[model samples]
Target: MSTLFGLLRKKMLAPSLASVGFAERGFPVTPSAATVKLEAVPQAVVCGFEWAIEGASLWELERRLELVEPEQRGFAYEGATMGYTILDAMPGGGRNRTRELLEGPGKPHIFLTYIGIGFAMARLPRPLWKNILPELSGVPYHPTMSWLAVDGYGFDRAYFDTRRWVDEQLEPEPYPWAGHPGYFSRAFDQGVGRALWFIHGGDPRAVAEAAGRFPERRRPDLWSGIGLAATFAGGCDRAGLAELRQASGPHHDELALGVVFAVKARTFSSFVPRHTMTAAGILAGLTVEAARALADRTEVAPDFDAPEPPYEVWRDRIRADFSAGDQRRAG
Candidate 1:
């Protein structure tokens, strides 16, 4: 038995004899290699049940078991969640600001929840709330001007499409499973986006319904565009998309579209920053932004009524700015 289990067993079998029993035996309460293996047994398929191996290697299975062990002992536990968490931490604004904002209250107050700011809002639990007042109020008042700061431009639309694929069609399999990317995708579609619409401006219930609507055909394209954006930019905003064009330069309208798509899919508060310059950095960047923007606008079905004409109009102005940038780049 493992040290913990041995101690537990002693407690269960003879509550008062635990200390004395170990002392008399002169045995340290440490878990032996055998005990570790014994404790590592897969509980879900153990005891009297038939143990059959499917496609998983014993090593992989063991690694998975180690993850849930609570001592930071499993690759599965770290690999899956850590990757998603890292991805989640990338988006509009700086990763630092995005993180501070998502983890706290933020400005534009789009993704962050500030009681008195850009839009109406409410307070959050102490543990959940992330205060951005200090960051926003800092010297030069240099609030993150571009969404590209978070490096969300690096994300590809396929990331989300893969999630959509597994979700809509997946045969049941034994062993534990996770949809980390799916969760990130949904967080944008359901959590962050919904939070932005209702918490920032619309009715919560209606916003919830609206956010749930997504096009089947566009899922793949949309995911691909987002993945591309994560590659170059941090976050997506009307202004940031325009900057992406400037920063990317020449024949790169697709990048512009990709960035736009990522923004529409989810607001970018938790974006990471990307600094590498690809060979066709300028063209690729511009192309991504344009593609993403087009994807976002086109994917939205025509029948929905406009709730915030002023906001939508403002957004259109931003889109037009990008159009001008595209024309300039083309010229």
Candidate 2:
């Protein structure tokens, strides 16, 4: 009965997309992953999700992020909401102001700051965001990327303070995970990848360079987040796509697999009104119909929108697609 219900949901999901104008106009995936001029991407690909942020920019929202009492800073989505709001205002004219804040006191909230900046990047005209990459090029990946563990603090802190979210780990993992140290860096890099997609202006080459800076073992999860942004937000060019494929190294499938997981997490949210068929279309290299079909084939029922167990399943599934020592190949 559970399987049948999930199958039905997945089936309905596709048609539901078509009903609300998430229709794929069959724009061919970029041939070489070169920068796809924003004008070239079919307007059909202009996800309506970004339209919401088009309103008046909330002033100093990022400033407020710093001000939020530590307890208040820990809510599940509020910090992100704050991040998006500040970026929406294009505070200090978007990246210019964020560039300063990236180094300023808001530095601690770098995870939320960059994530919100990514949200801003999704809305802005391209190349504007892409140029900022050079400013970040000199930075190291680990500590910079690991700051994302701060993004997990709300959940981990909640668990620790109230015993509320997940079973507390016996001791902290090296990186934060539901109050565990395990996978902390992975969590951090995932945020970095999501933000990197936007920072590179969806250029694959930039993404590759950014991902390249990370230690090799760390690249897969980072690529996974990049894939998520590239898919959910629809920016990477042919070269970017190819770079992602190549850079996935051993974790290529796992990286692409993140798109599937992110699609599920994001589509269920009110944040993406088109239900992400467009994102699915981008990642699967499919027309709307084909993308929908693929999702239906892989869809499963999970009580939580972003369940953890299947994340591992998708990760391992990608790994299994490769034999021992098989590396991801770029076209």
Output the TM-score of candidate 1.
0.25
Candidate 1 C-alpha lDDT tens digits along 109-164: 22212111111001112222133222334321122221211111111111122243
lDDT of 2 by residue, 1-331 (tens): 1245334433432122233221232222233333333222212111211221222123433433334334223121223433333343443535443344444433443433444343333334444433422143223221233223332332223212322221231222353323334555455456555545544556666667766766677667667777766665555545455556666565665565556644543432323323245545444444444433444454333322443433343345444543332434431
Instruction: List runs of model 2 lying over 4 Å from the truth.
Output: 1-176, 237-243, 246-249, 270-314, 317-331
lDDT of each: 0.28, 0.41
Worst window of 10 by summed lDDT in candidate 2: 43-52
> Top model by lDDT, which number?
2
